[model samples]
Target: MKNLIDYKDDIYKCSRCGLCQTVCPVYKATLNECAVSRGKFNLLNGVIKGDLILNKNLKKYLELCTGCNACKDFCPSRIDVRDIFIAAKAEYYKTNKLSFKEKVLNSYFLFKLVLIVSRFFLPLYRFFRVNKLIKYFENSIKKMGTAAKWLILLNSAAGNGYKPKIRSGSSLKKVLYFDGCFNKYINNETLNSVKKILAQCNVELVTKNFECCGVSYLNDGNIDEFKKIIEKNLSKLDDDFDCIITDCASCYDVLKKYKDYSSDPKAVSLSDNIKMAWDLMKNLEFEALKSYKISVHKPCHDSYEFIDLVKKIKSCEYIEVKDYDKCCGFAGKFALINQNISGKISEQKAQNYIDSDVDIILTTCPACLLGLEQGFAELKLSQNRQKPEIMSLYQFLSSVCKISD
Candidate 1:
């Protein structure tokens, strides 16, 4: 992993262009120039020159980012803002000792523990009709605090799915599946949906024990922890599989970059064969069970043009909301750490979807799904307005669409 000093050149190349401000969700919400890339580059540039020290105050400014890479994509200098910030954050971790709160916030163990608890209680949550009760008392919860905005996201695990019309055929493709931490821990609805669709295409899935993609660790600049998990994942990567597939955009993004972290030959081969499940579902056709208006929230980690696939669904009308490709502001821990900024950004993005009057809002990543739900929940929408249903794209498809192929 590279250090902050290594990105000195990239920091100096900022050119003080304010173009980044145009796309940064943080800047849009807070209007803090320091919250954007140009401002961050200036601070980093000072640190490189030894004019400023890396302290918690300076580090707080760096954490202002969503790691959405919106500015990176829009940059005229084409600097890698995401990696530079990570490198800088890694620098912070090197010198400063982590506080207990910081440890819990960054702890993937505790994060997964929350999901494990959720999964364990899901049966009781459903059997006692707790989900419905939560929905009934949702408005009361929202009044309690901003954190309560997660009510929709927390209750999202249970939903209806279409019955599989076809059985798995003789294995034609040796596709290894990478079910992300959210799917593996909370529920497998998204993975189940992908498998249902993949079976229609006659693709047999191979499974393996895999850890969290270490995206949070990477974003937190916990490079050592990130690489430890990366090395472990690279160890289990089978070279014989025709391709490794993922339904989560964020996981796909991280898995595709495995070779960047490790030079192991398996890492290179794994990156070579990394594929989004949508690539395999191209020729297959699906139709919604009912006529409804649907829209999509493009995940920041997504590189695939799967929106074309979403638009191709028969019977369901697809509406393109304004700035549908913008970040949902749920950039993992960034949401909790910067709740006000996140809530502000999500509110505006949610309004766009509201204006379009979409019945269902689908995204490829679990975090994005939560982000959308957070946006809607925080709005505490009027009784007159209907909040669109939020779901992972695969879950939405498998639950509402049938294998027309």
Candidate 2:
């Protein structure tokens, strides 16, 4: 429950050296000084000194950030820009009640509702060759609109018909699986893929009724709601498990921070066990089933240790494209708030992959998956040429690799 005042010293620590401008994706895309952390810090410093107002317009400026933390990582001050921005947003949320339209548009409940409804129709989306149909009409669909383009890409990914080998093995390590909202509601492809791989490794994949990782709530400065989700998730944990595993980078990032928001001592213990599923796979071996070229889009919040493991896969050639570590520009709600800027960043990123001409573009976060979809949708593909297929790191592996361990 720290306020913006708590971040005053952090704000003033900004040296105005503009190094943040070099790493910020939004600033790179928009070239707007206000879009970067150093610039945002300057405005915050003004507000702290009582020279400016923390008003709605100022909140809009804060919204420009994608919560990528690139600047925070590169800053000499090591300022936690994400937390400062959240504190500032919370300060505004204290007085600025959301309008009904804003509430509905940003509603987590509605977002879940949409996913639930989509899940309901998943059988039909797949039964009728929805993915192939979309592929067949790619050029025409591109003209429908941006949302349509993103829909086709994301939906095609889930139903893309890549099947992993079903393996049989005995259980050994006990790990609770945190199936994120994307895997739980929209599609189980990633979850199913993880389960299959772990099964081969003789790992007992435990399940629990864990809730969303509260990443959206935290970034929006809805700390109250974020804390509720964290506590709810913590209440589900115990010492019976060796560790907690998640495939989604965003979920892993937020789960690892649960201790920062809660007073219940269990939060610390559970957070200590937060892990990417790749941790278990690091010891296992995989036999490559394809000779395709592949590359990865590292999620902003990912542990990212899996990159080396991926490169180690025998037959898949890993091509390191330029700015492989840059943001995909779909920092969750940041996309909704700044669509033009977000699209520009994502499209620029997509062009990199297109230029590399890799067969697959892999990522860890579901939101980043959508950002890729959004980016490619903005492109006009050459006739008879399709963009590279997108997949979760594990999802692609499950299809192309078998645990030889």
lDDT of each: 0.83, 0.82
What C-alpha RMSD separates each model from the true structure? 1.9, 1.8
> Which clashing pairs does model 1 show?
none
TM-score of each: 0.95, 0.95
Model 2 stretches with alpha carbons more than 4 Å out:
160-165
Query: In model 1, where do residues sit more than 4 Å from their true spots?
Result: 157-166
Model 1 alpha-carbon miss at residue 67, Å = 0.8
Question: Model 1 over residues 277-307: C-alpha lDDT tens digits?
Answer: 8888878787999998999999998863888
lDDT agreement of model 1 with the native: 0.83
| For model 1, the run of ten residues with the poorest summed lDDT | 157-166
Report how far off residue 312 is in candidate 2 (Å). Answer: 1.0
**Model 1 TM-score on a 0 to 1 scale:** 0.95
